[model samples]
Target: MSEPLLEVKDLNIHFFTDEGVVKAADGVDLIIERGKTLCLVGESGCGKSVTSRSFLNIIPSPGKIVSGQMLYRQQLPDGTTTTIDLAALDPKGKDIRRIRGKEISMIFQEPMTSLSMMHTVGDQITETIRLHENVSKQEARDRAIEMLRLVGIPKPARLIDEYPFRLSGGMRQRTMIAMALCCNPTMLIADEPTTALDVTTQAQILDLMLELQQRYNMALLFITHDLGVVAEIADEVAVMYLGKIVERADVDTIFNAPKHPYTQALLHSIPKIAMKREELDPIKGMIPNPYRRPSGCAFHPRCSQVMERCKHITPNVTAIQPDHTVRCLLYEDMPEQVTQKEAMHHD
Candidate 1:
């Protein structure tokens, strides 16, 4: 097997403020293979976005990555691979700048805020292409228009001249996609790319993303709260709570045989069309304030299967089966009992 496209181990990021320090991402571990989609699913503020931003060292001011390694296996021009530690590089330094956009790019959550209203969409895309590639202005413009067409933007020749505000929500998102793919990056990080669109438009965007991922053969780090979207796009799913990944497995295992209470709650919360008579089972309580996260398990306060150990001792992530891991005490002592309970609940 080939080395993973990207691997993160024990990544910890924090935001320091006058109020308190926000432990945004703590001991997060993830791996993304080439041409695969890894969905980072969790409620808001679970560190999904922060973790993805760490890839490019783009975390905003007051936030710092305290420790951990971001190993990127870069494919060199000579067809060999070089492993570089991205976390060690200066965020705004030349090395990171060379890697960003050229090898890896991101599409942020909101296109309105991500795109500049003053510039034409075409110019923005061309700027990104020129920033990474040594191309003439005319060549960059031609490539930008081609990318816009590739992303399903209609009348690319005309739309390229319009500012972001002139485009609809979906069109703006496609523009963002086009910009991110302008360099044919090896990896794409999309943070809730379809959250603001209608269902039909959301589906179209998702399909476009999948199609582009296939065409470019790029690894995708998709961060979102939508389980339906995960089911549709993710080959693997990681369930995050507070600042930790509570569970991770293949999409089928995550949805059907989830071990952690938090994972089960999230899955249960998804509305089902077949259960017309059933009420939505939203997760109880709310994500705790990052400054004062709950002791032991961060999800313990809201976990239905909570135990005494959960309130006092943090459970280590344990493997329930090959490639399936969960961080919960319920599986530590009586794994069978927890499995039976999950089975009964599903039935």
Candidate 2:
């Protein structure tokens, strides 16, 4: 009944390269509620990482958010709530700087690259705490050590003085998690934080994140391409193609009754444990070139259920049931889609 923690509508992010503008995130919509996990799942280049980065107004150079509202329901210290449009703020300004790590923090894909080799792990974590809170050096260092302990790192007091390169892959990632949570952020954006680790370590990191999410009552926007990870940690799943989200639903429906052709194809692509290696059914065609996107539905070129209308008329996002939406011509005739379909056709 309460407003969602974050709501994004028609999020359009583009990269203006000399060759052409790359439509990285075109008309992307997302909603993340408090204390829940929303997994943005798609193959590489589907705009998952870019979309998450936009929350912090950190879209890399040469690419920027062209339009869209990132409405964050910020809880004030006095218990009242205020909505702030993160997309409109200056990326280098103090407002976003204050909120970036304190209210919303991000864990990048690779810890080795994300963590600074020059600084001790403790210094990096303490720096984040000192920046947000009016705390002294000793106080911040103590807090950092406590966070390291909380994230399951052994001998935190000693390891805190060590460089990132000295730690194992899993340990470095745990330190990243500790750093992200040091500020007790309201929401955490993890961009494939576990992809580089082995299966056992990945599972451990996933469990740790879920545990911490519950402990902190923080919303999580996890970006990943692994369906297995999605099944393990996601409450809701959004399937992205190119720059558009083709389907979104609760984890069960996304895996079981996915409506969009692309979603179905993606689900089919997952290798079954008992199935033979040759039986693996990967998606049919390569993703289209971004500079020369196909006409109408971007997936039509490879969509097995493509229709004549798909060649020219883009499909509207249609809700087949409560809390379930799919963008595909096959669902265009659904009663809920009539109005949107008409509008798209008119355009």
Candidate 3:
């Protein structure tokens, strides 16, 4: 309701493969309120990573942003509303460099990949702290030590001296978080931060992130395929398919009142011990290739509830509630969707 801390509107990304240009992301629109967590959830290769990367203008070259507007908080004095035309920003511009870590930071999918194996974890965090702030080495080191402790790394004094290869996966991830938080960025983009860890470690990392998010009052863009994880930390959820969002809603509305058929299928696919084995539903089709997306509604080919109109018409997002939206004809008449859906089961 208040001005969003960050706004992503009509974002489209295209990649130049050996074969052809692939549309990795299409028409993505999202709003993040200050201190809220928005989880982008879907199956692997659904553009969650690409969308997150685009925020900081890090989508690999040859893969360019075709269209988009990424606006950061408008109140900053250095710049009014930074509506970065991601496609137009020169690599040498100060805008992105200034925001990269100080205003927005990212925690990559793999901890090992993000961490510098050659540097001591302490040195890395301290360097990041000094890079953004006018602080002495001692001050930076002290801040780094404090961050290590905040992330729950055991023996902060000893662990900060270790290299990435020297620690376990969980500890390595904590080190990554420490580095990311060193600058106290306005927002944090976490892309599958728990993907590589074992379930126990995954739970702990998720818990730690939630705690840190609360402590720092950060706007978090959490990307994960796990609906279960979405249930745990997301204040809001966006269900993405090949290159577009099929549904977006508050956590409870998403879990209990899914409007898009794809969303319903996705939520149903989450394994439940309570569900009968045969009654459990799995979505029928694999993700379509980005280069050869299905015409009209991308989900039409796989959607169980697909109608003839779905094959030729790209569904637009229709608001079903103040906080809920779905890209489906079923939601064409917000009120009728509720009545029609209910009538179908009536005697």
Best candidate, TM-score-wise?
Answer: 2
Stretches > 4 Å off in candidate 1: 274-278, 333-347
**CA RMSD per model (angstroms):** 5.3, 2.7, 5.4
Alpha-carbon deviation at 60 in model 2, angstroms: 0.7
Instruction: Report, for every candidate in turn, its global Cα lDDT versus the true structure.
Output: 0.89, 0.92, 0.84
- Candidate 1 vs 2: which has more TM-score: 2
Model 3 clashing-pair count: 0
Model 2: CA > 4 A from native = 334-347
Q: Write the per-residue lDDT of candidate 1 for residues 34-77, one digit (tens) a residue.
A: 99999999998888888899899999879999999999999998
Candidate 3, 94-188: lDDT as tens digits: 87777787778999879876788899998888888887789999999888989999998878988878888999888888889988888887799
Q: How far is candidate 1 from the true structure (C-alpha RMSD, Å)?
A: 5.3
How close is every model to the real structure, measured as TM-score? Answer: 0.94, 0.95, 0.91
TM-score of 1: 0.94
How good is model 2 by TM-score? 0.95
List the candidate 3 regions with Cα displacement exceeding 4 Å.
74-88, 274-279, 333-347
lDDT of 2 by residue, 76-165 (tens): 999999999999999999999999989999998898656899999999999999999999999999999999999999999999999999
In model 3, what lDDT does residue 181 have? 86
